[model samples]
Each structure stands twice: as structure tokens, then as C-alpha cells.
Target: MFFDKSHLVALGGNMPSAKGESVETLRAALDRIASSGCELLAVSRFYRTPCFPPGAGPDYVNAAARIACDAAPEAVLNLLHRVEAEFGRERVKRWGQRTLDLDLIGAGDAVLPDAATYQAWHDLAPDAQQSEAPDRLILPHPRMHERAFVLVPLADVAPEWRHPVLGRTVVEMRDALPDDALSEVVAL
Candidate 1:
């Protein structure tokens, strides 16, 4: 614990079935976070969706979580990476697949200054596809409003979760969805 602040954390990924970290194995990840002294404020129900960055594989079960922690953003991110590794996450491809994906969705309206700092402080490597840095923690995520996988589950726990940037609610984004890229949520 370093600083008292409320934040939203989004979780996703297929959790490498072959390696054995399945979607249902979330308790272990949560335990790790708890060990780090983070307080669980809220957690979204799991939603299954077709894998994005599409390929031949099982679908992903995604969810969002709202947490309160006293840790610095970088420290919290470091802990998240450790959780992913503990769950056996492998970095073999660009969104190719994963065991667990933990993202620092929002940090009390804090901004990262630039993409390089954003990625570095979080120990994240940019996906060659993304071109620019964002201004804030980029919550409700920059693309979350447009991605059904993110919205459906996000809507479950935070239907009224407002995007600080776009100022739209999760439900609003889901209702405004135009394409079929995001399949409906499958209850787990």
C-alpha cells in the first residue's frame, strides 16, 4: 500500500487451458491481489466471448473489477504482471492468446503523460498496432466502448460506468454498437 486511490481493473483472456490455467481459475489470481493488500470493491460477472485478434482457439471469458488500493500505479501494475506469470501467461504473440490479462483501467482520473511512459511504468510492451499515447488511464478503455467483449461484462457490473473521455455509459456504448464483432455474453 502506497497511496489511497480507487481504480478499475479489467480482466480477460482464455487462461491457457493447455497449460492448465482455465477461465474458472480466478480465485488464485484474486488471492494474489488480496495478498498485495488491495481491497476488492466490486467484480463483474464473467462473460464468454469469441476471441479477438481472431484465430482457431477457444473463446475467452472476460470480466471487469473495481478495486481500492494504496499502491502506486506502477506497483499495482507490477503485481498484476506477477499474477499473470503465476497463472502461466506466455508472451508468444501479439494478443495471440493469454492465460490472464489484467489491465489498470482507471486510476482516479490520472494520466500517464505519453504512451511510452504508460507502457514502461506498467511494464507493458506496445502492440505494434497501436500508434499513439493516451492522455488518461484511458478508462472505460480507449477502445472498450467499441468492443463488445469489454462492454457486455462491463455493463454487467458497471452499466452506468461512465467513460471519462467520451462521457458515455457502458450500456450506452453497448446499445450503440454497430457491428457484430462482439458476440453476446455466455453465462458461466
Candidate 2:
């Protein structure tokens, strides 16, 4: 499962970087990602999303991508982190505004770590989610189901991709969010 070719990625950025605006930064990051042995397939249209934590920072430009990378989940995660770093991403804050963010949503139907670990992080309380961070990597991104910024764009590229644990499709997850939340994730 880790080596599954259908690798889903969620790309985002808020702050300006060496590449200029978020969209420009993300586009460059996508190219970097594709060149790193991962074949970039389809990419979702860019969307403008409200920054999380309210006034924590400016809004973000987000998008999702589908790729074919024959690599282990951890290796893929490391690759993503490395890409983020290349664009000046810092691990200073948990959920902090960043110059680049590349999240490995999932690899095909892989359930990282294990179902139990995934569930533990999935069920993590909202307050805890803001302050706490997992020391290890979790697959399908524990909160992908709840973030319109993530799912709305994901639906664009991998609408039919089902969550390995929740058994829900990306479109289904996106539709389940409140209308107000969905409204915040507007197409750019």
C-alpha cells in the first residue's frame, strides 16, 4: 500500500517566498515534486481558502494533486518535507502559516502506521488538534475529512478516491461539510 502509484497530495501556501505569491510558490513546488521521481498526473484548480486559526495569518491558495510515485509512505513524506523546506517552509509552529505546505494525503489505499493509530489521531479533540502534533507520520491525513481547503480541491483531482478507513469518497467528504465552510474555499 505504501508504494501505491496513486499518491494523493494537498498543496498550499499563505506567505510569500523566494517564488513570490502563494500560487507561484505552489506551482513551483509542484514541479519540484514531479521532478523528484514522482509522475505528476492531474492537479486541481487553485482555490483561495481562509486561513485557519482565524487571524493566525493571511488566506491561503490551495490545490490537490494526483501522482504516480513508487515509494514508501515514509519516503514520500520525507520527500514532501524536503520539498517544503526547499521553498523556505519552517517547522516552527504547529499549523503555522507557511511559505509552502505539501501534505501526503494518502498512497492508494494505504493505512499508515495502523488503523488504531489512525483512529486515535482521527478522533483527537479539536482543541488538542490545535496544540498537539503527532511525532510520527499518519496516513490519509487525520483531518483531511474535515478541511474544506483540503477536500474541496481533492475532489477536483481524486473525487472517487475513497478514504481507506472511513470508506467515504472525497466528494462525499467535501459535501458533508457545512455550507459556510465550503463557501470559504472559493475557486481562484
Candidate 3:
């Protein structure tokens, strides 16, 4: 079955880009998304978030945007990567700082790479998770539920978008997080 649904994308960055500051880079990314054929729907307020690994680099500025488009999940992901490259993003380090990070958090209720594939990566041990990267895109982002940086901003733009596998709303996922989980994500 084919579906045309709005995709949710998470935007983040810590390193300055050709656009200047990280926050400006994120804003430029949103513009890129719109220009890539997706209708820019909503953008969450920018937040100051500490680096995921703590001290990997400068604190990142994060936000989320909802976009309506007919592109398939992989195509949308490819577009995101292209935008990242346009802004000077590099893959030198895992979870390392970058000029931009555009994560395709979810696409309506469509799950890419199948359920089993998503679960395998989703269930990976934490240590292994950091060291490994999937060969293909994982829909609904395998780890979207576990990170406050992703969820907090997601709640702003798509609180009601349900996860295809977890069946939980973005707000529910964010609310389920421990207070300490979101301690470092403060509004900018």
C-alpha cells in the first residue's frame, strides 16, 4: 500500500556552518526542507541542549519540523542528508558535533525497513548502539523515544503523531521520560 503522509524531521546542530551560528543553521535547514518539495508545516521553538555524550562538543540547538510531502521515507531521508551536506555536515565521529543534523524522526504511520529490522536496531544494547550504525534508514527513528532532546522538540511540532511500532504519541513519549532526562534541554 502507498501513502502520502506528513513526515516529522528533527533538526539539530552544534557547529557553525556557512549560515553562521548553529541556530541559524537549523533555520536554514528548515528552508532547505521546504525547497526540497515538502510543504513546511510547523517548526518548534529552538532549545539549547547539551551534547548527547556530554562534552563531545558545544551544546546543540535543537528543534523539530512537520512537513507534508509525497516522497517515500528513504527519499525524504536522502533529502535530509543532502541538506546536511549542503550545510557542511560531516560524519567524522559518531554522535559528534556537526554543522547540521537532520533526522527523519517519523513519516506518518509508515514504517520503513520493516518491523523486525526496526526492532533489532531499536533493541540493540546501549554500548553496541553507540558503536554501530544501521546499513539503512530506520523509520520512526529507532531511538526517538529514549532521547529528551528529540522528544521535547518533537512534542512541540507533532505531539499527536503516533509511532508506527510503539503506538505512542509524541507527548506521551516525552511525558514518560524522567525529569533528569530532559534536564539539559532548555528553551533558547
Name the candidate that leads on lDDT. 2
Model 3 stretches astray by more than 4 angstroms: none
Choose 1 or 2, whichever is better by TM-score. Answer: 2
- lDDT, candidate 2, 51-120, per-residue tens: 9878889999999999888778788889999999999999999889999999999888888789999999
- TM-score for each model: 0.76, 0.97, 0.97
Candidate 3 structure quality by residue, lDDT tens digits, 16-89: 99999998899888988898789988999999998889889999999999998887889888999999999999
Cα RMSD of all models vs. native, in order, equals 5.1, 1.0, 0.9
> Per-residue lDDT of 7-73 in model 1, one digit per residue for the tens?
6677877755333555555555766787888987778887787776666466887887777788777
What's model 2's lDDT at 178?
97
Report the poorest 10 consecutive residues by lDDT, candidate 1. 131-140
Backbone clashes for every candidate come to 2, 0, 0
- Model 1 has an lDDT value of 0.66
Cα lDDT of model 2 overall?
0.92
TM-score of 1: 0.76
Q: lDDT of all predictions, in order shown?
A: 0.66, 0.92, 0.90
Give residue 62's error in model 3 in angstroms: 0.3
Output candidate 1 Cα RMSD: 5.1
